[model samples]
Target: MTLTLAIVGRPNVGKSTLFNRLVGKRLALVDDQPGVTRDLREGEARLGDLRFTVIDTAGLEEATDESLEGRMRKLTERAVDMADVCLFIVDARTGLAPADRVFAEILRRRASHVILAANKAEGAAADAGVIEAWELGLGEPLRISAEHGEGMTDLYAALMPFADAAEAKTAETAPVTDVAVDEDGEAPALPGNDKPLQVAVVGRPNAGKSTLINKILGEDRLLTGPEAGITRDAISLQIDWAGTPMRIFDTAGMRKKAKVQEKLEKMSVSDGLRAVKFAEVVVVLLDAAIPFEQQDLRIADLAEREGRAVVVAINKWDLEDEKSVKLKALREAFEHLLPQLRGAPLVTVSAKTGRGLDRLQAAILKAHDVWNRRVSTARLNRWLTGMVEAHPPPAPQGKRIKLRYMTQAKTRPPGFVVMCSHPEKMPESYNRYLVNGLREAFDMPGTPIRLTLRSQSDKNPYKGRKKPGPSKLRKHLK
Candidate 1:
């Protein structure tokens, strides 16, 4: 509950500018133009060692009921609701406007804590408008110029109490001690551990998802029941297994919307989606009794679509009759059902007995390591050359598809861009072939491999250059 301070105002009142000043970075898009910032942006703010969550909201404006701006206004209202304190800003140079009055009324009703700020108050010219801000009945206005960086000390002093209060609240709510021992049974060191690698455990209801996490932690921290949809919010636990730090997120059993009833359940679905977005690795849990169902496939496909490193965990493996046969059948079904996540780590585990927790942890860490692995440009080009040599690109329209150069653009799903003579004309089959080759070469079999083809003809400098630019001394200077 770090105090969330939202900087909100009408268009072109220097809200984003003030945000950049407070956050000490140009995170929000800043321009003289009005309504340049449409989305609500969040950043960590620090003023003299005091920390708080700062939010930059969209410019509030008058809107008709059916207009696009009206929808944007609704979004802004939601941002206001999320904030603990609202920094209501007004333009000190332009004086108070009707829109500012409207926003003041909104904040008066909504915000528990409000700080009235008169921005652009650097000189005597803005003095009149700074006084005008008091007419809104929201106490003394903070006179400051966000662009010129004036009057920040006063702002910091005003925000100190809220920051301290939030810190106290956080200390009260956080668990006293939530640490899991390593395999060697030593008290795990706290606070200085590795950054939490977000891992989402998602599956249908009654898939032993919570039980699996409890086994890993060696405690009954998460509630375990046979009932579906027991866990509403996506609860997260910071766990250390074998010296590796991981943030395990236990998501609710996501069901089809048609079957969902309560509003809380809908929010639970949204929570699951949020967890997926936050996660770097997603472990799609499956019941050994009913493996590779349509819902299970959907969950795994969603992880692949999100470009997350995926591992399929078949839970309750200890209870399965003909365990070896079931495991083999499930593996075949997994490969056949979701080819997009081919070779994904499918490990059997008993959440009740902790049969395969070690294997699960190992697979998760391996997937995470591979997800962050970046292939060198030289290695990528060599792999591409070998791929091309093994099976040449298809000839379409009697022209050989010329793939000139290939380079990895980014990792974390291992995206590569192939600069080619004709990108659109390159066959889809060829793209799939190259993707498979990349997976095999890079040892990134299960993760999604992105292969993009860019037509390099226009990118060649020779095509865009004029024969000669004005100066004859240009060549001599070179």
Candidate 2:
């Protein structure tokens, strides 16, 4: 059983900061601005030896209607309802405000378990506020500073009882297995077996990356707002999609190098790039209204270069008019701009409205399968023979280069090695031809295909040596 803790408070009370602290990563975007977080973001959190799910929610406001703030408050209340325990935080520097009091009363009435925390309690200025927090009547508040990493031991102590209860319940309900089972009882593990697929969603700023992930999850699992660059760190969440277990990473939007001027933005871009490298399949989400921007092409090309399977998702299809014409134009632009991913699946989805999500999921699974595809050595060699016969290697120096052999060196990007007469002299165009041939022949479209050429001479020991007629002394004696 996984325990869940929701950090709820008024605006700018360090809820996201505490979330980042507990998760041991900067997953939530933190700034001095209030209401920077408008959605509920959940992460696996750890404090000392206790591990549980932590949720960072938007600030609790007094609104209760259809306005944005009202919607945000409703979302926070939903999180409070779903959580096993609510860590209600108050600003120790500013003391307890009327809004905090209101929310504290709301939690008192709603939540079964509540732990009041006085954040920013590291300085002498917070002493008065820390004392004031007791007036809220939610028990003794734990004094802590989320930014400086203070008072976690007390927080851990406060959370141990809940953790223990969860663990006990889990142990009680867990199915028992026989320790001394038959040797043949265990199932065999095969290569290319069922493993969780790693998919990374990457795109330019405000391309609805987080929105798409949230729609796929069917919950507000990541913070989404009108603000661009709302997502900073690359956050990963495990989910089951149509019986397929997948680990999806929602990454920060990558802008052009010239536009990425701030240090924090640079770090965000670097984190996004790392996620793409670690992922098996990368979904390059593009804004449907602004289909193929320069940055979009760059991001797609980067994923291709990283050897991850590429899937293009045109987001915000709900907002696009004349769907047929727009989709045709988008496809033409995709093919023209990104020839490397020519046949990759181009899915149109409205992440906000949850439209076309089924197709997106299917496309992702297909791309993952293609990424893990492996061709047999015999088939690869036969294909290589045909390719050589169809279009022979270019003779740079009036000497026809002999293509000797071919075999699949590896999979997971489908790497192949070709032993030939002058690998260093092979033209770039010829290499492209072979790669294109492999893609078309094996039906490996959009997935990265690695074809390496090796000089056969490098593998031969006496390729350039002249053999004497036996040993000179033995020949003379005979």
Give the top-scoring candidate (lDDT): 2
For each candidate, the alpha-carbon lDDT, in order, equals 0.84, 0.89
lDDT of 1 by residue, 63-84 (tens): 9464546655776787788888
**TM-score (all chains, Cα) for each model:** 0.61, 0.84
Task: Please list the Cα RMSD from the true structure of every candidate, rounded to 1 decimal place.
Answer: 13.9, 4.4
In terms of TM-score, how similar is model 1 to the real structure?
A: 0.61
Give me the displacement of residue 456 in model 2, in angstroms.
3.4
Q: For model 1, state the Cα shift of residue 135 in Å.
A: 42
Number of the predicted model whose TM-score against the real structure is largest:
2
Error of 1 at 259 (Å): 1.4
Where does candidate 2 clash, by residue pair?
Answer: none
What does the lDDT read for residue 28 in candidate 2? 80
